[model samples]
Target chain A: MADIKSPVPGTFYTQATPDAPVYKAQGDTVTVGDVIGLVEVMKTFIEIKSDMAGTFAGYAVENEAAVSAGQTLAQLDG
Target chain B: MAERSAIKRLFIANRGEIAVRIIRAAQGLGIHTIQAYSEADAEMLAVRMADEAICVGPAQAAKSYLNIEALVQAARDRDADAVHPGYGFLAENAGFVRAIEAAGMRFVGPSADTIDRMGDKVSAREAAQAAGVPVVPGSKGRIETLEMALAAADEIGYPVMIKASAGGGGKGIRVAKNADDLAQMAPQAQAEAKAAFGDGGLYLERAIQSPRHIEVQILGDGTDAVHCFERECSMQRRRQKVWEEAGAVCLDEGIRDKLCASAVALAKAANYVGAGTLEYLYDSAANEFFFIEMNTRIQVEHPVTEMITGLDLVQEMIRVSGGEKLRFTQDQIVRDGHAIEVRINAEDPILQFMPFPGQVGSMRLPEGDGIRFDHFLYEGYQIPPFYDSLLGKLVVHADTRAEAIVKLAKALDELSIDGLKTTAPLHRALAADISVLTDSFHTQWLEPWLEAGNLTATP
Candidate 1:
């Protein structure tokens, strides 16, 4: 199992906007550099890209939750 | 005769440096300050400094600062006599102003009707024209169809700008050089405006080339108004003003008088109350200015005007909101020196101005004559990433523009906020740039300068 962590401390979102669909689902194939989520810091959205290729397990944090830098945002299973 | 309803308890319905600035101003006037903060901002400097602080909601601004109902309820609960919406968030929200007034708490700004009127681009343009203020030639109102846009473009000439009627902060804006370009761009602009602001309305203006962003600061007491000269905010990145200067040196005395007078005329005509800024696009080549929009609240660059005019704009606004008359006549208000204000945002200048929110370490601030730093930072404070990147504003004033630049350089060098990245290096480089030194830049200058890797070599 691999964990994807947020690169910055901010509000994390699983969707592009409030009404949009989630970027990924459990058991979905995850490619390296694929945007799994976005971390909104200081009103600027920075995409949280995957670094390892695997199957998407699930989001470790709830949508719109405040997260700290290096906090686990998602999990990936090989 | 109107009795003065003194604002004994002032509730600050905003956050960050401007919140802290408001708290200080209120405290100076012996007003008990009640600062409203989000859950994430409980530990902020302003929360700690205010006479009392209350948590309105969660970390997100939508649940907190922008929660108009919650803010009004909180202010009422705290027995606040007045609410001060500083700058952003709901500062210009007409709904919020109405709610505050309905709740029996005075909103320290113009009336909700004034905000609604001036906030809309079409009505504001009409108001300016009615007041004899010059405006860019364009469609008289919102363009409902492609045919109207084409007709307006034909009459206004080519190179017209397609702008959203509901837009601010440079969003929903596009420039088209010709009729074909406008035909292709207007639908996209409308769609974007609908998606962003729930309005598909769009407007048009003849795009001014190489314009300097000049604004006049005016304070009105409903019956009378006076101007505090003007500010030159040409140095901007992404339509966000990075550096601002008072007494735009580029304007000759003749033009300056006309510009300031026009601003006062608008304010008087609108029966404007409190402090407001009338922004304009000045084509220095043509030596002409055109009114763009009116911000019906105190602006971020207000301190630079205060520095030069020796006016406490915040206090003045509060006083006016409390049924006070105009304090200084136009002839009595004097501009003494040149002032410059550089925004110190919490962004890594080396890494594309990305937001850098971290725990503050040891801090060193420049202090002396004609130097003022407005901020909400402390030694052990952890900056929350839920807000904008503006950490502070370092303002400097001197007898002349050149001397002010010299002082700004010295002050920037003396300041330090350890354990976080900031835009200090960018300001340092700009202070030494030849174009900036000679005051030859315009609204479109800084982005190109940054794109050319000007900040890469900064030490």
Candidate 2:
């Protein structure tokens, strides 16, 4: 198991917008370079991408949760 | 006057240095403070220092600090008797002031009507003109059509400024050099204003070329007002003040007296209460000054004034808001010496001052007599990326301007913020710049100097 950490400090959004679908779900298959979530700060958005391929275990932060740099956001289980 | 001592619990509806400043002042007044924060500010020092703290909304500024309803609700929930908007976000917001008032809690600044009157640039201009204050030479009020705008531009002469009536934070402003530029920029500026501020109201003013940016600090009790002298803050980049000094040495005593008196006049005309600032453009060559705009809250550089005057402006503001009158008269106020302030932000000057949002791995605040550092940063503290880039302020005082500059430069050299990039290097370069050392720089000088790649040192 590996912890996915956020690289920026902002509010984590599981979806692109309010009307969009969640970028990833529990037990979903993931691959390296796949975008998982977004961090919104100062009106700018940065995409959080996967670095290692694995199964999406669970999210550490809730939808629209505030996060800081290096804060764990998700878990990947092989 | 109604009793303001009734305000025992104060709600600080802001964050960062200003929030900390207000908290200390309120504490000194024997009033407890509650810090209203967004989710992003969970570890902010202000939150920890306040008597009580609560998260009002999400991380986004619009949903948190700028959200009027959320802030008011937090005040109610915290059982706060008054709310201090603390300079930004909702500081000059009329709707926020009105909402706070409607909740049966005192808003620490001026009334909503006063905010509305001074917040609208066009109306503020009219008010200044009505009060015998000399405003910039353009635009009687908001100009609706391009033809009218061009007409005003021509009358004000070329190189006019097209400004959003509701603009702040350096947004929604365009400088037009001629008729063609005016035609091209007016509508584009209008669109941006509407998009950013939700108010597209545009007005024009003759650009005061290379004017020294000076502002007078004032305190009022909704009836009487007194001036706290002036600060020379021409050292700005992209319209944001970076370095400020109290007691502009360039000003002759005669001009200083007039400028401060005029500031008091404008504040009284607006019925301004609490601490506020009236910005002006000083045309040194022309030997005249013109009113620019008034900030209806405490300023970031308030300590510079405080150091020279030996008065606690924030404390006085709270006392006045609590139904007290001005504590000191004009005669009692005196500029004892020179003071300088430099703002350190989490930005890289080489990358056009790009915001470097991250955790502050470590920091060393310089300490000495006549030196003050106002910041919320702590070792291992997450410098949140969601808010303004300002990380801290370094203020120093001395018996003379020369000594003050030397002390400021030395302090900057000692100050360090590890992990994240800082504008400290830029400030270090400024401290070395001959123009800054000589106190001869103008408002438009810093950007070009920065573009010349002078900020090379990293501290």
Candidate 3:
């Protein structure tokens, strides 16, 4: 299993916006460089993209939760 | 007339450096200080410095700093005598002012009606015109149709700005060069405005080419007003002022007098209370200035004015809010020397100004004469990522603009904040630039300088 970690310390969101759908779902296919979520830091949004292709397992952190840099956000099954 | 009583308790309804600024002013006045913070900001410097601190809500500003009900309730419960909405969040929000006043606490700003009137672009333009202040010639009011925009563009001449009536922060604005451009761009601007602000109302203004961004600072006691000179904030990126200077060297003494007088006139016309700023777009070639809008709160660049004028604006504003009269006449307020303030934001300037929120480590601040640093940072403090990236302001003053630039460079070299990237290097480069040294730049100058990799190249 490969884990997707946040690149910055901020609040992580599963969707592009408050009213948008989740960028990915459980058991969905993940490709390299595919956007998985967003991390908002200091009022600027940075996209969190998948580095390795895999099957999306589940989000390890709750949506809109404060996260530290290098903290695992989602689990992916290789 | 009622007897004036000094505020016994002052509650700060904002965070970061400005909060610490208000707290210091309140403490100096022997007022009990109360600071409000979100869960993310509990460990901030202001929280530690205030006499008392309260957690308002969650990390998100919408649930905390921007929440009018939470802030008002907190202030009332604390038995606060006054609330200081420093600069942002609810500083300009009329509803917050009304709620604070309704709670029997002084809001420390202008009345709600004044905020509402000055907050709208069209209404503010009308107010400026009525006060005999020059404004950018364009539509008298909102242009409702494409045909109306076309006609207004024709009258205003070429290169007119089509802006949303409800827009701010450089959004919902499009510049049309000619008639065809106006016809094509107006519809798109209208549609974007409708989608963004839920109001597609648009206005037009003659776009001044490479205008200097100058603003006048004025303080009023509801009955009288006085101008505290002007600040030039033309060095901006993404419409955010990166560096600011007081007593803009670009204006001659004659034009400066007229500009400051017009600002005071507007304040008197509005019967303005507390501290406010009248923003203008100045055309250096024509020696003309047009009032654009009014910010009815203390600004971030206020220190430059204070540094040059030797007046504590925060303390003065609070005194006026407590039913005090203007302390000094316009003649008493003297501008000496030149002051410059550079914003030290938590961003990597080399990386296109990307936000960098990290824990503050060993910090070394510049000290001595003519140098001031206003910030809310402490060793080992973790900067919360949910807010703006402005870490602090490094202000310097000297006998002349040239000397101020020299002082800025020296102070920038002395200042250091470990464990986080900052925009200090950007200021270092700007201070050494020839155009900046000669004061021969405009509002559109900084972006091109950055785009040309000036920040990356060593001076």
Candidate 4:
């Protein structure tokens, strides 16, 4: 299975907020439609969901890191 | 009392560097200023620099910059005596100007009627022709059918440019070199014209070969007007000016005088007041100048003219709207040195000038005796995607054109911006090229140079 990608160019957030519970962690088993992270651009937040079901190989980028279009985020083990 | 009273408080009805530029001018003149912005521009440099700032609406320009009611309401709330439309949003909107006047505040520009007349390209062309300005050979008015366009093209000859009569910015423009080409282009042009300008009216003109795009800067109060020389805007990508320079390098004295005189004549004919530009296509080899259009507001390239003429066009606009006569006569207007302006956009030039919006980390502008940078970018400022990618303008002036080009190259090398990519490298490379360095260029220079791997510096 292929990895899900970011929909827009922005900063990546792992969870809702720092004090809130983490949505997904490193090496966590996830499925299609599972919440991966959030991409925030210009104060607009959008959920990043996995398109394939598999254990995460950890995110390719760090939380709050600047990202560009077509940049890889996570790798799903087929 | 209203006629003689200077503008005490001015409201800038736009955003970005132009807003900042106006604010500085107003401050210098002891006028309190207010800047209105969209939600996306909360942290913009212009907002931070203004004495007062208010959020007009969301990121979308239609709800913010183009929102007439919101702009007028803000002007009223701030108790502004005059509203300067700057360049883009409502600068040429006749209705907005009328509303501002109706609200008992001065519109720092020509009367609403003049804007309306020049906003319509067909009427503007007729006005220019009547004022002894040479216009390109083309159709007289809007074309309703393919047959009509075909007939007009036949009379005007082939290799003609078809354009939307109601729009600018190179939208809905197509060139047909022959009969077969015209057959395939007419309907497509009409559809594009309709979609872009909400008007399907199309006009045709003879497309001169590699003509340089030149424009004369004119300032007026109602009774008299003066020309502030000309700017050569031939360097373009996607039909939009990327780089511009004052005093077209190729045009000789005679052609330059003719172009400037025609621009002044057209402005007088339209009763145009304030800072406006009359754009023309100058065929240097033939020494013929054809009037293309007149921008009914201040232009993005006005600074280059300012660099050469030592005039504050925006201040002139304000004083004129206050009913003051034009201070300078035509003969007294002088051009000193050569000046060039390059629009530095926050775009990845290698990616076809795609917008590269991100947090601007560390911004360092170029500095020199003759270099001037007009921008709104700041450290930690996130560039929004809802508007134009123009980050700033870098302008330079020197005693000679060759010296100006050299100075521009040096200034560009010193400039640096961290975070998202920009077109600085592309400009630097273009400046260093032998063709551009020696002033051997045309309107077709930049795009083809990039495509041919000329500007290969990585972003």
lDDT (CA) for every model shown? 0.94, 0.87, 0.93, 0.84
**For residues B1-459, what per-residue lDDT tens digits would candidate 3 score against the true structure?**
344436889999999999999999988878899999999999999999999999999998989999999999999889998999999799999999999989999988899999999999979989999999999988867888999998888888778999998898678678898998998999999999999999988989888989999999999999999999999999999889999999899999999999999999999999999999999999887788999999999999999999999999999999999988988999999999999999999999998889999999999999989999999999999988899999999999999999999999999999999989999999999989999999999999999999998889965
Better model by lDDT: candidate 2 vs candidate 3: 3
Candidate 4: residue pairs that collide: none
Residues B250-309, model 1: lDDT tens digits: 999999999999999999999999999999999887788999999999999999999998
Residue A62 shift from truth in candidate 1, angstroms = 0.9
Interface RMSD of 2: 2.4
Which order, best to worst by DockQ?
1, 3, 2, 4
Clashing pairs in 1: none
Q: Which regions in candidate 4 have their CA more than 4 angstroms from the true location?
A: A1-78, B1-5, B139-204, B457-459
Q: State the lDDT at B165 in candidate 2.
A: 81
Candidate 1 stretches with Cα past 4 Å from truth are B1-5, B139-204
| Per-model TM values vs. the true structure | 0.91, 0.79, 0.91, 0.78
Q: 1 or 4: which has the higher DockQ? A: 1
B1-459 in candidate 4: lDDT tens per residue? 554437888899998889989988888777788999998789888788888988888766778899999999999999998999998889999999988988999998999999988888878888998999998888987897889889999998778898988877676678998988888998899888888878888889887878888899999887688899999999988778988999887888877888888888888877777999988887666667888888989899899999999999888888898778888799888999999999888787776665677778887788979999998888888887666778899999999989998899898988899997888888888888888887777788777788998776533
Best by lDDT: 1
Predictions in order: chain A TM-score: 0.97, 0.94, 0.97, 0.86
**Taking the candidates in order, what DockQ does each have?**
0.90, 0.43, 0.87, 0.07
Kindly state the number of residue pairs that clash in model 2. Answer: 1
